[model samples]
Target: MKTTERVEQAFKRIKELLTLVTDWTKQPKEEDALTKEFREKKLQLIEDLYKQLGELNDRFMFTHESEFKTKEYVVQYDALKKKIHDLEK
Candidate 1:
């Protein structure tokens, strides 16, 4: 895919995953009571987040051309990175 498309896809996925993480975080849980199901879901989300981060990093690594440095793509990449950071926390 083109750089813009790749960034857009990553940004979209990050937003979707952020919603999932936010919902998961808002659930009520007992003190230090990490249930098996909750642990499993959290682990899965972390894994998915890491995968997305790696893909975004890889795409940016090879994308040094000025053509791909449009204002829109830069904004999308920044948003994607920020969302990934939030999800990580």
Candidate 2:
């Protein structure tokens, strides 16, 4: 796939995972077991997507510095990490 397509896919996956987490958070206390399970799965999916995004960013960095700057990727990755960390808490 093209670089743009790959980036778009990664973003789409991130958005989906975020939505799942948000939905899981909105559940009531009665289904704590199911909610916790869903949250754990969502967190795992987020981590996997974050790793894929990092790998794609690295590839982009190697191929096109002008289009995909490393510093911007680093900032975005750090922000993502912070968001994930907050979710874990």
Q: In each prediction, how many residue pairs overlap at the backbone (N, C-alpha, C within less than 3 A)? A: 0, 0
lDDT of 1 by residue, 35-79 (tens): 777777776876776777677666666787564555746676677
Query: Which residue pairs come into collision in candidate 2?
Result: none
Clashing pairs in 1: none
Off by over 4 Å in 1: 1-34, 64-67, 70-89
Best by TM-score: 2
Tell me model 1's lDDT, rounded to 2 decimals. 0.74
Candidate 2 lDDT: 0.81
Candidate 2 residues 1-89, lDDT tens each?
Answer: 99999999999999999999999888564767877799889889788867867786777668767887878778877777777677677
State each model's CA lDDT, in order: 0.74, 0.81
Model 2: what TM-score?
0.43
